[model samples]
Target: MKVKCKSKSAFVQPIGCMMLSIISGMGISPLVLAVPRQVSLHSPEQSAQRQPQKIAQASGTDTPQRSQLIQQANALYSQGDFKGAEENLRQFTKKFPEDAFGHFQLGNVLFQQKKSEEAISAYREAIRLKPKYALAYNASGMVYASQSRWEEAITEYKKALEINPNYGEALTNFALAMWQTNKKDEALSSLEKALNIFKTQNRGEKVNQVERILKEIKTADEPGVS
Candidate 1:
């Protein structure tokens, strides 16, 4: 996709972007809280700040009016209406700033339009309103990672993991960041943890991506003329 953000920030690391492509290919899945004894290395926060709102559809009983607007914004987004989506989201926020999910979806649409700065701002607002929002942290991590801000991206991903230890994307991205930082062993370890988590989650595409990177890294590390 063509990213057209207001900021002129360049990509942080090719590896991170590659990982993002892998995750994107798999689709964004809503995270579910893990039961105790999942044997996960990381642990997610239960309530960082905000409560997720119910996503009422256009035909939903209550908030039919708001639902109509959300549907309109989504349609505009689907039609490549970045500006329109922005407007709709802004209006939506004005009407319901407490709606963390609304801000998050708006941020997603902004990111899709390549409005990195705007997307970041929207995501920050989402995080502010919902501190426990692991997904918001994940989204923010992507924005930072795309800008090659490896440290910031890592921080965001870590925060996401802290909120939900089973957040596969955060784990995978964190591992990718370590790889980009040249921490080969650490990267492999992180990826291994992620792969283990995916085994039960059925995130096959993501597993394949991580495995691909691991193979590439191993091949490069073979004893040879260096």
Candidate 2:
């Protein structure tokens, strides 16, 4: 699949986009939080900042309208109506600036539209609002990677990993960025972690992908290879 946002370099990393799935270690099946495919609404402040596990749980007790805005925005985003998603999300963030998820989704929409700087700003705002927001940091790192800004990308990915050590996406992205900077051992270590995460989660596709990456990396660095 053509990436939602392609990198400037020919060295495209597999599975580069952040998977906005049910967060692991939450004891919830990753199947539970399928945004865009089904609708779930909750006050971002109530659910997000308090519990990463309950990130997608709905109280239905607060911010119904705000939650609706996010639902509609996510729908628009899935339909490739990035402008419409942006409009709804802008309204959402304007009203509930503390909602890190809103800002992060808005950043995703902007990033899809190739508005890198605006996306970065939104990601930064999400990070500021929730310092432990691994998803925002990962998304920001992906944007940097797309621009071939390896150092910046590595920094953001490292921060994300520090916050959420089980975040497989960030680990893989971090490993790729590390490879770009010739940190061979660090890259290999991060990729191994990612592979283990995928294996433990039974995400066979991701495991296969990571294994491919590991092979490629090892091959490239072999004694006689370029």
Candidate 3:
């Protein structure tokens, strides 16, 4: 998950590079292109576990048909068929506009295609549908981050953290945006918090990765280190 720091402008490495391993275990395929890692999408298994209840609540009836549609989209996404996934998700959202997950999935697919603006719109739609959608906020922040919109990214990440303080992914992303904005101390603090969360979650690999980044930051901050 570790990538050598290339330049100040590239603070966050490709999302795929950082999260590929984790996503693989969750039955999701990692993006092959080298785009800055933005947001983590729910794995197919996670989506399946949660979607039924969410669909029932939002649609007032969770039909087998709706579940099948979602599964089809998820299958396309897992197979790296972004176009198919997008089409299916678009249909799903149009039919169930209140389903935040559908919008979120659409955003993820658009992002994978490098349609930043469209992706942001989709993420925003998801958030509008579900104001407390922390993952959508995190995903939006990542798009901003990729565009080097550090301040906006920070704001979005903060909103996500407000909704879910222990959101490790958001905390990690927040730290990266903070560092890019030259808030070195704040970035270090956030990374420490993220590290602790990962450790508590028993994500040993992530803990190690964050520790490496933290060490690099501290070392670079030392006098004459550069």
Model 2 TM-score relative to the real fold: 0.75
Most TM-score-accurate candidate:
3
Q: Is candidate 1 or 2 superior in TM-score? A: 2
User: What is the lDDT ranking, best to worst?
Assistant: 3, 2, 1
- Candidate 1 lDDT over 95-155, as tens digits, reads 8777666788788877777677888898899888768778888878877766667789889
TM-score of each: 0.74, 0.75, 0.76
- Alpha-carbon deviation at 27 in model 3, angstroms: 16
Superposed Cα deviation of residue 208, candidate 1 (Å): 2.2
Task: Please give the lDDT score at residue 190 for candidate 3.
Answer: 91
* Candidate 2 per-residue C-alpha lDDT over 52-108 given as tens digits, one digit per residue, 9 for 90 to 100: 323433433236677688678867866878899899989988987767667877887
Error of 3 at 56 (Å): 4.9
Clashes of each: 14, 0, 1
Q: What is the TM-score of candidate 1? A: 0.74
**Positional deviation of 63 in candidate 1, in angstroms?**
1.3
